[model samples]
Target: MLNHFVRVTGLSQSAQMGALPASYAATSPNAQGGKYYGPDGVGNGALGGYPKLIDPHHNKVVADKSQWAKLWEISEKMTGVKFDI
Candidate 1:
């Protein structure tokens, strides 16, 4: 499963917050932490780590309530063949 993480940068005076440019890691995201912990491959907190997961994908869908148009207008000023999603 693809995990999402944002790169954070800043300093704070808190145990929760370590040194500046803290490696606030957010990995091997277990959406259902504790409630459900998957399998691990080897050593604790190791890279190439596990908890094997099968990414679930939803059907490609377009919402109806959205105001944005289906096709993306690449650029109003640019002249080129624009691709649509």
Candidate 2:
């Protein structure tokens, strides 16, 4: 699992592969604005080991923090939730 995490961290930080556009995301400045997004996967796509991990079609595992961070960045594109990490 440690190795997988390491791989994920690498993929998440890559500029072309995992780094996602987070500036354009709609943010919730509202402290009491209520929850706008859910806590589940929203089916967003991009370069990541997520599909590789969850998708049966993918036959490899990459558990990395940076990699997951990048995946979260892309998810922000769709959900408009910027990860504090």
Candidate 2 lDDT, 3-58, residue by residue in tens = 68867755333443332222112343422232222211233343232212133223
* Residue-by-residue lDDT tens digits, candidate 1, 24-83: 123444344333232232432122223443222222343332423434453522566655
Model 2 weakest lDDT span, ten residues long: 31-40
Candidate 1: stretches off by over 4 Å: 1-39, 52-85
Cα distance off (Å), candidate 1, residue 71: 46
For model 2, name the residue pairs that clash: 4-63, 5-63, 5-64, 8-64, 8-67, 9-64, 9-66, 9-67, 12-67
**Candidate 1 local Cα displacement, residue 40, angstroms:** 1.0
- How high is the lDDT of residue 84 in model 2? 77
Candidate lDDT values, in order: 0.31, 0.40
- Model 1, C-alpha of 33: deviation from truth (Å): 7.2
- Candidate 2, lDDT over the whole model: 0.40
Clashing pairs in 1: none
Q: Alpha carbon lDDT of residue 31, candidate 1?
A: 46
